[model samples]
Target chain A: MKYVNLVVIFSLLTFFACTSSDSDYQVSDIPGGYMPGDTARDFQLKNVNGKMVSLANYENAKGYIVIFTCNTCPYAAMYEERIIELHKKFADKGYPVIAINPNDESEEPGDSYDEMIVQAKEKGYRFPYVQDKTQEITKAYGATNTPHVYVLNKDRKVVYIGSIDNNARDAESADKFYVEDAIKALENNKTPEISKTKAIGCTIKWAS
Target chain B: MIKPMKNVNLVVVFSILTFAACTSSDGDYQGSGTAGKHVVGDTARDFQSEKVIKFPELQEYITTSTDDKVKVINFWATWCAPCIKELPFIDSLRYTYDPDKVEVLLVSLDFPDQLSKVNKLLQRKKLSSTVWLLDESDPNLYIDKVDPSWTGALPATLLVRNSTDQRIFLGKELTKAELETHINKLLN
Candidate 1:
């Protein structure tokens, strides 16, 4: 009887452990290890104008500043102008910023394609405000959050994966401009001092 | 004949276990709290039926509970289906646990306009758990403040036994078994 009780307890423990392990939030590590030399993957995403734009469209560009942002996240909103400015600063030098809205429209109605266009126009976005229709591109890029950024080299490989800068709440408190520093380093043919940092923003509303 | 019967029984047990595991993982118990549709950017005053607490003071409320008890702060929203489903289970938990040892705090992420509706829902459910509306407008700002690693997902939970060791669960809906296990582990 004691042995049976012990067996039952052990089985229950195993069951709980298995369940907890299965339910444990298995957040995928942002696929990293892509250095300055790796080639970037080419993807075609729909622009706010309902036009598909590919990496090849930005021909002869030195690099690409791919940012996964959305209409709602305050963090993304705060960095909107900064993103535009980054593109304006680098577009002439052959690197143009490409913005993608990865939030599912079904979950967040404001993130619908029409709303994206409206928001883009309202914000005066000069860059291509693309929509990840199936969120295939977003998932492929492993963009889990709005305002999650990836600086890909001209070769199309991810050179940096993190925030636009250090400050999301207060711009004044930002000490290290990681994105800017990475872009400058890439331009200089030198490796960025810091390659990654945790991104802060709204969770991407995937069609689960 | 007996061998065949035993094999059939084995199959039946296996199927039952599989169903239980699947349901345990994904099942949510639906409650009777239906929220009325309210457009975004609506004023806090528009929805007078729901209770709205001052947003900034939520943290203080959670942290500064005068009672010496374990606080289970559940972040939920009326729009979220899983959150609605978990309320009854949470109420059950509140009933089962000792009030002096455990306190359940249901922090609604519902818009200020929907507060009255939520309050009515709570009242209808006869839920006596200490409830508060999270008044923070922007999740991006407050989500991190709540926990730097939080992804601002609804139906998330934070179980605080004090400042030192707190368990944070980020997901939609939790089963009674899972809740019991967590509570037992923490309490023990």
Candidate 2:
């Protein structure tokens, strides 16, 4: 009798304790290129000013710092100022920061193109902050998180792929600046020592 | 003769197993992770205490693989949408496999302030699986240790099977079918 009661109680507990939470996480069916030696696929994204921006837009750059970031994620917001600083410090050196928000607006309303424009204007963004229309740009790069950085060379080879640095919360306290170090290495005609460092960041909101 | 209560228990357990077999969908997780130190690797058989473990100890489980059981370490957070999306499926793995063959370590990466939220969610979800807090603050010190393929994403899963030297590292979230396939490979 006791065992029967326990089983009944446990069954009810399982039903009450577990179920769905209405999370609509989407993954792209198309395979992506993420390995270090792969060439990047050229993608066109709409900038905040209603202009189509692609790799050709920055013809003067020696390489590119393609950062996949969004407005809604707290981690992305934390790196906002530092990302601005990255542009300020590296753009002149031919390594410009191109920010892309690949989130689906229906699921992540805060990351919609309209909200992106507002964020760019309010943040005084000096670089191109664009929106991935179909999130194909995100999938082509195999981008998994917001603020995921892929440093590309003149030939569009993914030279450095990973986080901006080891620390996301407190930039000042950061010990290893992965993105900065990669750029600085490229400047000296050397490879970034730590080519890939996978740190945590916000998952890119994929379109359902 | 088995009592009616015993029969009920058997029925419920079998039903749970069936529920575990169905349902599929998973994803990749990327975000900041914290750390701490505990020697969980040394004590896989003793993981039922529900005591919070630090990062180093968890690594011990990975590095040592002392007990030779297949270890499925899932890195997730309470607030992550994808992480929550696949929680039940990940939790279901527990009921599907015998404990002797599989040890599921659910490492929650919630911020220190969000511990209560994690507790509540675990309770509400009825995740009776083994849960741990990745008490590490430094990513550089331990990210590679988890799996070199991971880029710090949530809903990420790592399967470690020492006997076959097989490690399935899915940096993204997984469907139940995908997860089961990996587990079956390890089991085989």
Candidate 3:
């Protein structure tokens, strides 16, 4: 009986290690993170509404558009209105946009908790704009840039990762809507065809 | 049928290798299009050119395939505070390091509209190293080539030592001493 228990535990450990993409955790070397199909981790962060929220809070959510975005980045600014639109379009479909400001506030005053609230209010963000005070969430997600989006499936699998769209300057010029397309595919019970793309924006401010 | 299958496998492998090779070597993107400007044999002055490199030209740009010159390529943007702060160390690197042995390429990650602003900043700082505006639209396409470890982050620097063909990537802000230490280690 004891031997059986040890075998069961060891097999479980091996299974997890194999299932977790080595690249997602190999973030010790480079900041690139969370390949498609990796399971998402749950976190408790302070939302702009002053409520402590976690992934578990969304009981009815089919999926999530978890964006590592902030107030200071021009790239984030470029996508702010679009992000709000994404939430509006998808929130009713059980996919809501959760914006997290992971930058160290001491380094970036514009991204301070107070400023986050101000930005959310000014933009009239319908979704929860949160803060990762310890940066544990950011590091776990392997978020390297602002406006980096990770689409989570109903099973909590990261279906897609990378930028919201191709165009940074003008939305009218955007030929590819990576995030929207991914969400639509997920809604139809299909995996996103393009699972990963590069996210270009201000590097997440680390407390060096 | 067997012959075609073999060829298909080769094509797949070559595509993967080509992608890996160019990710860090995209520093060589500007090496072409200049006619006898600073040929390897020539004693070059502080090399700075205003040439614009579109995405099409980038497909052919690989500086490592050439001769012995340590290439230091930095990917920076005007909006990034750390990138702006770290520019001087790269500038100082031009004078402190052996110019004949080292070649610095400061590639600005500025957009097309920001060209005048980037040029103004370069002039204000009096940066002597050759500067190039990264004209490619999709950063995802080139950021990996810039440095596979780089998450398209600002203040990413790539150092290529010619003799041993060593390529090193630093994807964060660095002080002057840290810059010197890295280059010296590369040289040795």
Worst 10 residues of 3 chain A by lDDT: A1-10
Report the lDDT tens digits of candidate 3 across residue range B1-188: 00111213434433433553356322222233443233354333222353456644533343444656677778787777889898877877767867877778788777654544564566456565677777666776776655455667677877776466566667677777776666776676
User: Which regions in candidate 1 have their CA more than 4 angstroms from the true location?
Assistant: A1-40, B1-96, B100-188
Give the candidate number with the greatest lDDT: 3
Estimate the TM-score for candidate 3: 0.79
Docking class of 1: incorrect
**What is each predicted model's overall lDDT from 0 to 1?**
0.65, 0.71, 0.73
Query: TM-score of B chain for each model?
Result: 0.66, 0.70, 0.69
Best by DockQ: 3
User: Which portions of model 3 show Cα errors greater than 4 Å?
Assistant: A1-33, B1-48, B55-62
Q: Report the C-alpha lDDT of model 1 over A1-208, residue by residue, as the tens digit.
A: 0112324543554565567521212332333323334565778888988788898998789888999998876557768878888988988988898999998899878789999999999988889999887987887776766788889888887788778776654466677787889889998998788766654445677785
Chain A in model 3: its TM-score?
0.85
Q: What lDDT score is found at residue A22 in candidate 2?
A: 15
Q: What is the DockQ of candidate 1?
A: 0.05
Q: What lDDT tens digits, residue by residue, belong to model 2 across residues A122-190?
A: 999999999997988888888877778899887788888888877776677788888888888888878
